[model samples]
Target: MSREVAIRVENLSKLYRLGQITTGTLTHDLKRWAAKMQGKEDPFMKVGEENDRTKKGGSDYTWVLKDINFEINKGDTLGIIGKNGAGKSTLLKILSRVTAPTKGEIKIKGRIASLLEVGTGFHPDLSGRENIYMNGAILGMTRHEITRKFDEIVDFAGIEKYVGTPVKRYSSGMYVRLAFAVAAFLEPEILIVDEVLAVGDAEFQRKCMGRLKDVSVNDGRTVIFVSHNMTAMQSLCNRTIMLERGQIKMTGDTDTVINHYLNTYVSTSSTKVWDEHESSGNDYARLRSVKVVDDEGVAISNSFIEEGVNIETTYQCLEEGSKLYVSLVIKNQKDDLIFISSSISEDVWSMNPHPLGTYKTTCKVPGNLLNDITYKVTVFLIRNSTDVVYTAEDIIIIEKTDPGNNRRGLYGKWGGLVRPILDWRTIKL
Candidate 1:
């Protein structure tokens, strides 16, 4: 690889045997070796040999990843994205050196730092200050190098009070902050991060993403980021790689890949009608169905900012005389919960008592407060603090459009969780 090319991949392929184990002993290995002496690869590599546990007779071989090829130039941030089982994480793991590719070759030409897991190089017994040095050393930073950036890392982590305390006592959020700060400040030539921001709060996630952008642009380093948050991927990365079932489905600019992923995701059925026995995995009540319709009672997911949203939820009451409550959770495209409506609140409408039958609860969101983005709807059914009847997350998606006249006003001046118009009262003193 040349100096401009930070990483190069050449026809990489990874195949995994589904349900059989290759013995390391001499006897079974000799038999397999003898068979392999012929003009053939592993028997598992044959076509149409994938295992089917639900079937009667099937082979126990499958391919997790087939032929793949790509290259990452210096100062390029490549965003890897796909559905849940789309081999995104597997590819990151391979590139991070957590696992080796079964075939082909990858040429990496610089020191690498990967934030693949939460608290990846952290020791529970070590203090926060000590763990910083430990992780920095793991990233090939010397003592002097760490000392030079020590204050910067500490300030970035925002855990100065707990730096002397043992990391085992820190909360998950604190641990994530410290860990991310160390990795970011280490200044490796190549950085690989996989959903590391999913753990922290919204403010911390914003900080982490800002730092990542700085590293990619200001420091002129290569970054490989994997995230299910499509909006984050859209804003942070210039190039995107879409993977599906261990194969490279598409690779191109950020807009194209994001549109491809979102279009595919939205085309799928988002609602299901539930009968009496259906449950949302909660013990309180079972959900019958969920729908987002307008005044005319038409089910739709996409909506303009000026339009009203009516969320209809149907639930089954198994026991009589129990208080059933419903709540709404609104999450932004970044998968961050922006607003939550619970029955415990006094400002909103109260949950009327329903008899032992199916009930429909509808909540309307005023259009003016939202910006142009996608929001996921989550419903919660509960009684008291102890009784959670049902909880359905990512049930419906609502898209807001830019209906205002001032396009520039909504563009860059303020980017935040809420886009409300505040009345300013100014008096000349």
Candidate 2:
């Protein structure tokens, strides 16, 4: 890939007013506008609070995005990730020219196409075919160029049958497919996408992901993708940036950024107890609590690598004739799942009907099986091996540290995720 800068953002920020009346917002904008009219600096640029939707801020205007900065290479793909209200969509909107920043500026080298929220860049009254032509025109494409790529776009979208239908009547999946197809095939130098694939099924999601890769790799385009799907981000993006509360948190390689995001921003617990008011299951079952316990049945946050661990889950079964089984997922600090165990792993629990009653299940974790690191456990209650009755993701976490008691001496760093002691007899004859 060429090292030429395709896009550069410097000190970007977005401010929004909370209530219906944007008097405060208008005041700030008017102040900025008057200053600009006088050829003076904008005064209300950096005076907004952070955009945290949870807690109420003192200011009427909050910065949806604050001091954001990044540079993209000509053909590099960058992934942006964060929780809700983290200014992900705002950033994309600013880049697509749908919204203007309150402060700072972005420099672009080429035409840009963005597939943001649902029904973006499309008229409800226009047919899919007409919208395609319109979007192409907006991207600086001539009618002849659009016509040359029309068939390919329709075919790739798998909506040739609905090409003439009004996009308002199309399903969400169909809308996203057509939107993504247009954004990708329109020949824009930089393509920006934001969580639109979540509206489609897994198959269509895979197709869109493949198209993203092809656009960046085969066509030498820059792509900026925003999604909560870590797997897709890791697969498609070579580099990533994580945002938190309208600010940039981390920016680097995809794996490193994703790891930091999962371990730090993602919430985890060592023990969880559900209250009666909280509902975690359907009519079939209800989860009560999940915890990591030692051999003596006492919950412990610190566990050794050379010792056994137990995961205890308690739940109340509600319906009769429900063949319920438990599944446990063990993951390391990086959110990489180490192993998964189902109740059916034991012959006794396979295909057995769990009657309605309060029950507690315990799963054992052997020593020398996992590396020295912190681990989280996710619990799932399944019925008939198909239906999920209840689930608590990352219900508990445990810190597994090395105690130097294993057969492998604590000399050099032990690689890999596990530390199993295999049977080996060296023969020197």
Candidate 3:
């Protein structure tokens, strides 16, 4: 069976003038006008550099998106993941028609309802009830259609009491709730949402996730979601695209793309060390180094799934007689916490006040306990039992690979964070 494409992008690209707007001078505008009149390409379109923010470019223009091409099928949920300046918002804005592309074209087959930002289609002075109707009408909804879904929108947003209130007076959370409700309930053929949903509470985020899932899975609508929350992306998106420096880095299933993005862009290693001036901590203590090691005390980035792995941290205590302990938090690629272990369990250092000196703490993770996957380690330095002196989040990353020694001929992927070996006796009753 052939699937219908909801959106198609061909050689899409966007360029921006650096430092100043309006092309910096009237001469450039006149040149662009002349080129358009002659049906010729813009003279400046070929002069811009790739959108790498870290480098100094000689050109006055930068290509925010370059030669992007993709197709989104109907009823499919697509995820876009990237770093801070990866042009994700720019792509979404272009798709929503908030801005025009510098070159190339996009074919959108249906009406697009976008929640790009808070109060995207809402007027501040207008009441929530009025904005809902206004947004629906903008999507080509008839008055009767808007009226029919009005109550449901209000109920989903949980803002019936404030329905009559002007949206200008609403909080950020309220604004997002109303905006999402309007976008989701207006029955647009395609929905585009950005990271603005992070403004809502946890329960609201979960609700919105469920609504997005239902929108694509059950309602047969196309969805484009952009978020830094990997867990949500993995849960909702069937396909994902990774963007880097305004270019498509990879495209495939949700897990593979997400993992590639994490390993490539998100800095992770088995060892992390800080110089004296760059150390992490307060005046009382400082963290100097963190690394993952094996039973032989050799620092390593890869470990066998059947051997124990040790997380080691070295810190200097500056204040005399200060009670301190080290802690570790492990998380998978989806940013889900696997477990947290504290050095307070050690007999020698647990709640013990020590003289000013350097100390090393090691936490050993037993073999056959963790599944074969990439895990990030976070280190926390605590004062006494309650106060946290410093936290080094995701300071180190370790890859646990299966050596096939304990597989017993079964090579399928295991589920969950841990794959422990349990002693089970099977007997016929």
Residue runs of model 1 more than 4 Å from their true location after superposition: 1-3, 16-40, 47-61, 169-173, 267-271, 274-287, 294-308, 315-329, 332-336, 341-374, 378-395, 399-429
Q: What lDDT does candidate 3 reach at residue 319?
A: 93
TM-score leaderboard ranking:
1, 3, 2
Tell me which of candidates 1 and 2 scores higher on TM-score.
1
- Please, what is the TM-score per model? 0.74, 0.63, 0.66
lDDT agreement of model 1 with the native = 0.76
Please write out the lDDT profile of model 1 over residues 73-93, one tens digit for every residue: 999999998876677777887
Q: What are the C-alpha RMSDs, in order, of all predicted structures?
A: 5.8, 8.7, 7.3
The clash number for model 3 is 0
How many pairs in model 1 have backbone atoms within 3 A of each other, for residues 3 or more apart or on separate chains, i.e. clashes?
3
Backbone clash tally for model 2? 1
lDDT of 3 at 364: 90
lDDT, candidates in the order shown = 0.76, 0.83, 0.88
List, residue by residue over 1-429, the lDDT tens digit for candidate 3: 899999999999999887766536577889889999999988888898899987889987899999999999999999999987899999999999989998899999999888787565679999999998887777567789889899988999989999999999998888888888877887888999898667778889899999999999999999999988899999999999999888999999999999888878654689999898884999888888998988888898888888899888988889998888998998887766788999989989656887899998888999999888888888999987888889987778878888889878986877778889999899999
lDDT of 3 at 167: 92
Which of candidates 1 and 2 reaches a greater lDDT? 2
